[model samples]
Target: MKLFNRFPAIIHHDDSTTAPSLDASLPARKWETILFSTVLIWTFLGLCFPMYDTDFWWHLKTGQSILAGNGIPGLDLYTFTDADKPWIDLHWGFQVLVAILYAIGGVPLVTLVKAGVVTAAVAIGWRACGNELPAWKKSLVWIFPIICIAGRGNERPEMLSQLFLAMWLWIAWRSEKQPDWMWWLPVLQIIWVNCHALFVLGLIVGFSYAVDAVIRTRWGGRFGLEPRTDGPPLGAVFVVAVLVALACLINPYFEEGALFPLTLYRKFSVEKEFYRQNIGEFRPPIDFVMQFGLSNLFVISELIVWLVTAASFVWLLVKKGRWSPYRLILFAGYSHLAWQASRNTNIFALVSAVIACQNFAAAEVIRSVSVAGSTAGDRPHQTGKRVKLAQGMTGLFVILTGLVVSGVWNQIGEKNKPFGLGEAPNWFIHDAAKFAGRDGFPMRAFVAHIGQAEVYVYHNGPLRKVFMDARLEVCTQQTFELYNGILAAMAAGDPIWQNLFREGEPPVVILDSRSSRPAINGMLQNPTWRLVFADKTGAVFLHIDTATRLSLPPVDPSPLMYPDGEPKEKSRGK
Candidate 1:
């Protein structure tokens, strides 16, 4: 109150009709309660998809390393190729979190935590959609956004970022009514910067609010509007934004961590061609849509929600006769982010849904509903019937959401992501991992599959080193190129592949059979390498010299492992 009194010109005035209070603590209507409950259940089930994210293993391992007093790693210790490479691990906080969760309950606990984080984020956004909108309308707008975000809902630190983002957005929205909520921004920023590289979003959200305050203050009087007194003072908001930005420097790396995203973006932009071609998340949504067609429900949901949000902006502009600068900036900022990377589509989905729902709430015309009289001009009976109909529709939508979660969204694009908990057994080359983790096995291996390499290193690292893993940021572009070259040569059955292998000096090679099928075939024909283990997921090869020195007999290389053929486990066959 004192802050607002000091700078009355900067407060925003709400011009909309008197509607239901936006307080979340207020008791929800019966239908709203039912709808929100069902939506959360649906969100939990949807995000509980099988853990196919291979990057998870490495992240968990890194977390364990941090917990073990090794501290947040400043050097690459997992891979032989990039040994001692400079690494600024911004995700140290998130890594420690997941590590602790895993220590408590292993993969099942991590899965539950992942589901809970995402469900909670969605719930926060749902609350921000405003209480004035009908329950059915809110749920309807929410369905597609939930579906869209579920595509990236695997176990990753980005999920934490999403939850934090939701919290920041809610704080920003409510700070007008509760000015002290703005102070939480800087505190959250300190946690966010150390957790994920996307922490800059907190600053962006604050900046949007501050700019909105400045604009409305300087120009509203000229446009024949009286000074508003709803929001916090402009100077206070600006101070908060600056404080939030400065909080980014509270990380372990301080200045470097504060500016790490820019450094990362510079590297990624330079190598965008490679990452875009190789990484599915980095690829445009259109690329997947074109390749997979409309069968991909996730892609379709993304498109629908995106288009509807765009229409919502137009609708609000026409109905209100003025745009909310805060919302416009959020819409544009997230729109550009989603357009650039498919990984960001989930965050964009949350923003778009909140904005669309809020717009509808603001644009809706208020009407009276008397307990003993008619609503608008309708008879009491008619109102009762409409209420029942809405209840039925909301119930039906909930059932359909369950069906989609259980059956439809199991797979996104070409990936086989089923709805469940725990890691997918087939995803990890477990047999090879077990064999490699043995007491006297070779310490260095050329890992052909990036995903398998992550798992392999988690199961066996420091004690063992890999040619490479999925730390694309730490690994040089030259290493990636050389790895690609080795894959190509091995696939072609060229003896030149042996020369490429010399660079890494790996005595053992491991690869996913499906991803590196041609290379497996080439290895079967090459006398220089001996197949020591083979399974459906991947195979392990020992150099002939290493096998001879160890007296390890080769597995039967007679039956060629075709891409379509499923081979039974083989170990040291006579």
Candidate 2:
């Protein structure tokens, strides 16, 4: 408040006004309320798709397997191609939780779980940014970093990591002098290790804090509060860090749990060159900046974070004449992670709040620079600051209102509102029911794209054993390569495609006639597969063996069914 008062003049009146007028003080409190509401509203935007995050399918199935009394998946079970391969189901706990939610209320429950986690994350983050002061700086730090993280906040186990990140930050920053409360750090790590591969983030935070505490104890009186306990603070900090690492091994995978994040990082980084092109989130922030223009919201958010980080460093340099090594490391480590892959932006977001909050809460009025006195002249400036705060609150209200209205008003108008998940807008849902027929399907097969796969699962379309669904990780590297190989071969009129199909032929195949034109063409060219059904959204190709058993009318196969017999320039399309 004093630092804010240094902005020329404001919030100081008569030098003895113990508490300022409600009008002068209410805006700060109201602005905090506004920020809390904004975080909730924005957190929900993550579930803007009815069947968001196709990966949820495998997670669901994995959860079911765990509930089925099978041990947490220690080996690959979903893919037919990977019988010998070991699979690391790192997020087994999260999978079971969401699966239970889904079983109870279906998609609505899943959506709620996602919104609930992200909302909790943002809420915890708000506190981590500091309850001691709710300045525009904290709001800026909270709002902009959230925008960066929300890009990948979907219905995935990673959402659990995000929540854990916020909690870790909160507990970590608060445990500086309150060493008695540090025992919870290991408990949190145990849950984190079972919940997501990002458990390493918790370890990193614990280590950073432990080291920072040791340095502070050495410096004495420089890093805020003294250890509340009689013993040195380093003992508590070291105990917490060591136990956090040890707690990670409690998962079913044991040592694998300890090394899970390293393996996952290796999984992504080994094929880093390929993922940068294929995975949108793996693309660097600079790539987004180049492709999406400066005015793009994502880019703008990135810029805000980078600017604030740079400003924080500059502020530290000016005040202390040298970089506080720990602060610089915290900012640089997360910022670099975020810069490298867009998905890790959540790390930067939650950590930014911690860094800002911890710094703000620790900072003392530099006795050399702070004005020790405020005169009667400061009275008029209070009104100006109050007005500015009011404007900030009003702006927050307007933004929140716009989002709520945009999301809710779409019921009868344009039904596909982006602000939140709405009912499935495509006609495929209604159409697929008619095609599946009253009689049960003997088995379930593969659907090429996620939207189509979602439609299949939603309507209970059958043939069994999908080649792969939204859960990309459920498939082995060999299987994924083979699946794409089949699609490419079918599209390119390669004879090897038929040979590939002969290797692992599904009784039924569902694909988009437009986007999967090449695949459809290849299927039709084969006498073994017959086009038994068609619709605007997609078509179903029944193998010759199953075509006789199914009662649906079989359409004659033709090359002319698709435009130029080529896949759309954009593989997945409207």
Candidate 3:
């Protein structure tokens, strides 16, 4: 009886002991339908897209290697520059998962899987906001987050981390009703640690909840906060938090894997300015503001959402006279992350959306405005008019949502390829990679773009290696600097660039024509390098001597030249 009383869900069989479910408190069935319909629309918007992430191919390649008897690689194998560097492949599980999905149904299936994970994560965040808020309002607020997350919703393992974080938050918020759900967190953490470095977020959230519960247990009314009677016991929360921390060490690299996020975190600092400046995603939102001067709608939208979220925090504290320690901590932490790097905006958007809803609910400022209900004393005519307006607005919103998800609105000013399956045109140098994998081509080449390197390795890894890829964790600063130096020197038409190449660096060079145009033009003017292959996707260049030895014909430059013709000063300083 004592055990059953303490943990009724574990051993109790009697209906009398069962607590009311979290859903029991929800307002109406129509709102549930509305919420789900909105979610479905949001999810469809994500699914109707081709693979656009540049780093996705390498992750898939790593998974294939793992399944092909490589296990979790202790050293980098894809890069010639960092072949012997220690690699703590925390993305092994995510890689293996996508690899299996790819094997089953190819790129389309992987795209579907990525969409599913992101939708689940977003849905869970919606659920964590609870059911008291009006579904229409929730739907409206949800659009902001959906837009914010859309920028970083590429096919990446961070999607898995987002899912795990949502699950953790859901479990924490519902601990009072389903205390047993807290136990599932540590189990998820074990998988999370193996999948992505962001598993550390799980521990931070768990400890925040644990610490908040502990503080509230005795001092709930202190600091003008309302007393809470519904949360789980302090001991239970703390115990699970400890278990969650311990689960981090269950990965292949153990402590090293668990601590890998710290290493990634350090990169956001000023010391890694090269990475911060060179990597588009790593650059801060302020940099975009400075460069584009409020002309960027994406960055402006994110800032508006950030301000709204901050306002909600202040509103909850001042108007409600209550504060959630966990939420405050989350706001502080994620705010820093979002400000530090643009890629983290997705996470902050989700967090801000949930926290805003929770704050409004706790403040009792927002009431459930059900489409089906009105107060008893209200005039029938007024109620009828109000209901009709709500219905009309909702119907219109649904229609617009349908049009947007159908890729109608998406067609306007979209940078990505039109909605479809398989890889985007700009995603890879497919034909070039295939050409490089042939018999006469060099086994190693200078891949100028990091995104293109992922493609090259995916098509011809193990048998062929790149100068570098997207694995910045394994690739040292010196190698990255050297890569930049070579490109800079090559663009200047300097002979010194030849000396910057490593001793065994291949005579072949691969570059995305769109991104490395200057280098391409410079190489075109150089008598030493011959353009062996040229196409819309990318161009392949080889040393004049190597091209002669292989009997490969150099491509004509007339077709690749600009409309105005080739620049008069092709060589900067020959």
Task: For residues 1-574, write the lDDT of model 2, one tens digit per residue.
Answer: 1111112122223221123332234554565465556656655653354543546656776677688787786655543455446777788999899779888988667876787788788777666544444344456556667665665656787788888988887666545423345677777888888888888987777666666556656764444334333322565566557778789898887996688677556545676565576557777777878886675665677678777766765665565544444565677778777777777876777677667554553442332322225444563475467457645755774675466457652342224435545333342423543454335453445666634554554444222345555444445455666777778876676757445446543535677655576787677777766777765556677767767766555675443354333367545663
* Per-model TM-score on C-alpha atoms: 0.89, 0.78, 0.89
Encode model 3's per-residue lDDT on 317-363: one tens digit a residue. 88878888878788888888899999888888887888877777677
Q: What is candidate 2's CA lDDT for residue 77?
A: 56
- Alpha carbon lDDT of each predicted model: 0.76, 0.61, 0.75
Backbone clashes, each candidate: 0, 5, 0
- In candidate 3 the C-alpha lDDT for residue 69 amounts to 87
**TM match of model 1 to true structure:** 0.89
The stretch of ten residues in a row with the least summed lDDT in candidate 3 is 16-25
Q: How far off is residue 350 in model 1, in Å?
A: 1.1
lDDT (0-100) at residue 397 of candidate 3? 58
| Per-residue alpha-carbon lDDT of candidate 1 for residues 528-569, written as tens digits (9 for 90 to 100) | 888888766788888888777777888865333543344454
- Provide the global lDDT of candidate 3 against the true structure: 0.75
State, as a TM-score between 0 and 1, how close model 3 is to the true structure: 0.89
